[model samples]
Target: MSARSGPRRPAGLGATTRAGLKPAIFVTLVSVLAVVVAAIASAPFRSSTNVESLLFQMAPLLLVAAGQATVILIAGIDLSVGSMMSLATVLAASGSAFGNSAVAVVAVVLLVGAIGGLANGLGVLSGVNPLVMTLATMAVFRGVALLVLGQPGGSVPSGLLTPLTNVYGHVPLPFVVALVAIVLLWFATAETRWGRSLYATGADERHAASAGLPVRRTILTAYLVAGLFAALGGLALVARIYSGDPLVGDPFALDSITAALIGGIAVTGGRGSVLAVVPAVLLLSLTDNLLNLFGVFSYWQYVAKGVILIVTLWGYHAAGSPSGLLAMARSGWRARDARAARGTKA
Candidate 1:
């Protein structure tokens, strides 16, 4: 037994430190703080009814974040998610006007989403950078949505909105649906071979391909999954608002990315879990709700959200130096040796 083998100061402290400083933890903490502040500031804000309303408002955002997480996990980003959502909302509303057949509305919405996703897949696989491609598609899709809707508004049938917006026996249906989807996604990423391949490809596409993974196919599938989720979010939005506006999803692109980042999804990819995103979505939604309750200006909300994102990201990088962990480790080792020599001379 050597000094190195002597009793250690238990791993619990390190584990606790890591957990407490995690990005998800920070998001949760900030969220709790915001809620507490909001409750104290406003007497009517502490009720269960308010909580339900907040969850209800967050449903679409949570759905979009779920989809965005998949795309980001694959080392890609989809700027067109918001535009696709807008298109879906318009399509669903139009379909409802024709016959009010829920199936028809759903099919049209999903079809548009799939087509938008296919465009993204083809662009990426064909050598276009994802940022440029999605950015272009974002403009195109938004334009198309504007052309279709010709304006900001269209009504969705009450039959559709009621069930979707219902809190089933005090349980919000949208929240429940989102929860189930998150669980399924968590399992898919954790237990499936495809999930492993996805992470491998995101970490290193060349190496993943050399290892016989179908990199292109995986990326394409990831984008498709993103599109599907965006469509679901769009549908939910229409249901909740009982109308579809051409600009309904304009804010979602930034909000979804912010949520995913806050949730601990690595921008560089291959270092996050879907479970981390749940708290992130809730945190953002709660912030928005509290601000609304206080009658804060919407423009100020956007500015505050942007500031929060920048600060959180800076803190995340500074905390672990994750981006330069290896380099920092080498420098620390050298500094430690220099200190040891100086100590011996003293």
Candidate 2:
């Protein structure tokens, strides 16, 4: 009411931003706590060697998850990314055919990824469901990778692998690449007009289209970006393993999605922050690392990841979407009251 009071900020936008940010804050705290506990419990976890390895393990997932998060933001998913990564590794290992040059391999892989993404986008536009379209591509890409190299014997030039895995002091180069990508993507999703369009379109495609937000273009571009990121993940994988395995990327499709969900990216699409993906990825990588260090069976690792994902989903269902939770609770209460009335009559 003061005469000198400045124009009030938009309350709705402020509330939305805060709502979107809450999960990220919770996840960040959880990640930090997990790190601290792990370090205290296992001296080896605090070692520089293990720290470097953890970063190395996280890089590929970080790349793939960022892209996954992008597509997810637009209410679309790219199941083919793991296969795309597989294809990239095989191509990179097909020495001499690509002039034995790392650059050539990278270029071709990126092109393939973009083309694959374009195909997915076009398919979705043409009435194909995103899940089915990407799933089909997943099979195709993996088959192509196998055709390129039936076995995992092809050699990647040390030139490509060496620099990718190199550490500057305690930081792995691949982690740096992942971190830069996360930062850039965070900026784009949080700051840019395109990012706003992405959130709008994902929140409601029909409404976004009516608002003239270029919904189609945003969807197509999102898929293309996902493809490019998956290719980058493939390249990172090459550095980690120093060899191409047709099945090397098999786990990534699920892993990337899991990371995105765990990072607070809404399953329904339009909510959440990309910045949270960093800690989400770290949490996953750290869990796996600690499990291995503690001599847990590989099968148990899968069980642990599944449990974590389920818990995250439940938390979001219960806390993130208040309306849905309230509706469910109200329905349940009405049903209970009806049953009580029937019992009284009896």
* lDDT of all predictions: 0.72, 0.78
lDDT of 2 by residue, 1-346 (tens): 1101111112333344466567666667878998999999998999998998898889999999999988887778889999999988888888568877878877888898899888888888788999999999999999999999999969887677778778999898888988898889877876676787777666657655766778898889889988888988998888788888898999999999999888777655666677777888988887799899899998888888877776665665667442212324543534533533343344
Q: Give the TM-scores of the predictions, in the order they appear.
A: 0.81, 0.86
Model 1 whole-model lDDT (C-alpha atoms) = 0.72
Off by over 4 Å in 1: 1-23, 96-98, 169-171, 295-297, 318-346
lDDT of 2: 0.78
Off by over 4 Å in 2: 1-18, 317-346
Model 2: lDDT of residue 25? 69
Instruction: Please report the candidate that would top TM-score against the real structure.
Output: 2
